[model samples]
Target: MIALHCDGSLTADRASYGGLIRDATGAAILAYVGKGEENSVLGMELMAILRGIMLCIQNDLRRVSIRSDSKLAVDILNGEVGCPWAMQVLKGRIISLCEQLHSKEIRHVWREMNQAADFIAAIDTGDGESIFNPSEFPLELVELIQNDADCKAYFRTSSF
Candidate 1:
């Protein structure tokens, strides 16, 4: 089974989403970061999920599990809650992707368990270009990725 973790970051001027896909043993398979226009945190979170699912589909992954730090996004994706007006389009796209996959699971995870994706999403690219399957992980994300592989917990304050 493939495991995917995704996260999103938003600032006054920019929004970004990131995701990491790993094998069952936690070896990195693919990593992606995408830029979005300024939007709600929930919107960015949903974008991350969409991006992750797209990656899985592109790679022909069928049995997959996805985790995200945004409970609202997870809940919405899982049909446990209603999506906001602004999120309906994104919600529809996510559902459409899930339909194409043979099997999929999405769940909520603590931010501590999601630091790697968070680190990627929070990168300041200076330009609004997306990163797709980088030849190497960015230097700043190396430690976080290592910690994730080792199952080390990260503690940080959230401004949410």
Candidate 2:
């Protein structure tokens, strides 16, 4: 099975999405980040999932288990909730792609557990989209991936 962990980030005028595809053993097969034309958070999230699905299809990786921090996106895709009208087209595209896969599982994870994808999504690569091989990962990203594989927990702190 392949594991796809995806996330999205949005600011006032920009939105982006990112994700990594891993093998059953949790080794990163490929990671991706892309800019989203839409500024909607849910739109960005769904686009991230769509990109991940496309990557799997392009690489012939099936049996996908997709994890996203967006509960709404997962629920919408799983038929557990109503999809927003604006997201219908993207939702349909994702569902159609998922049908081509041998098997699929979509689940929601907390943002802390999803830091790697979150980090990647917020990156500004000065390009429309970027793909990273394991060897090409930055140190911070490598650490995040390793921590994830080791089941290490991440905590956030802020100083006001």
Candidate 3:
């Protein structure tokens, strides 16, 4: 099984999405960051999921465990909530890709648990997408990915 962690965020006028793909042993396979085709947050989230599924399919990975920080996206895909009209087409495509997989599991994780993907998603990637091998990752990104692979916990603080 392959484990995919993905995230999406709005930056200025554009939305960016990114994530890392890991094997069952938690070793990084590759990392991706890209600008969204649409500016909607949900659109970006769904797009990230779509990209992850496509990556798995292209690599001939049959069992996928997708983790995202978007609860709404996860809920919608899992049939726990209705998909918005604007997202029906994208959602359908995602479902179709999922059907091609021998096993697919989509789950929501807290942002803290998804720091690496969140950080990658916020990167300004201009107009195109970028994919990186583990050896080519930026220092900060490499650190984040390592921490994730090591199962290190990340804590976030918010002022109320």
> Scored by CA lDDT, what does every candidate get?
0.84, 0.92, 0.87
Quote each prediction's TM-score. 0.89, 0.94, 0.93
Candidate 3: tens digits of C-alpha lDDT, residues 1-160: 8888989888678788888888988888888889887778899999888998888888898899999999999999999999989999999999999999999899999987788888878888688898878888788987887787788966678798
lDDT at 80, model 3:
100
| Cα distance off (Å), candidate 1, residue 55 | 1.0
Using lDDT, give the best candidate's number: 2
Displacement of residue 108 (Cα, Å) in model 2 is 0.6
Top TM-score: which candidate number?
Answer: 2
Clashes of each: 0, 0, 0
lDDT of 1 by residue, 43-155 (tens): 88988889888989889987889899999999998989988888898999999989998988998999888888998888776666465453588766767767777978556
Clashing pairs in 1: none
Query: After aligning candidate 1 to the native by TM-score, how far in Å is the CA of 106 from where it should be?
Result: 0.7
User: How much is 19 displaced in model 3, in angstroms?
Assistant: 1.5
lDDT of 1: 0.84
Candidate 2 regions off by >4 Å? 154-160
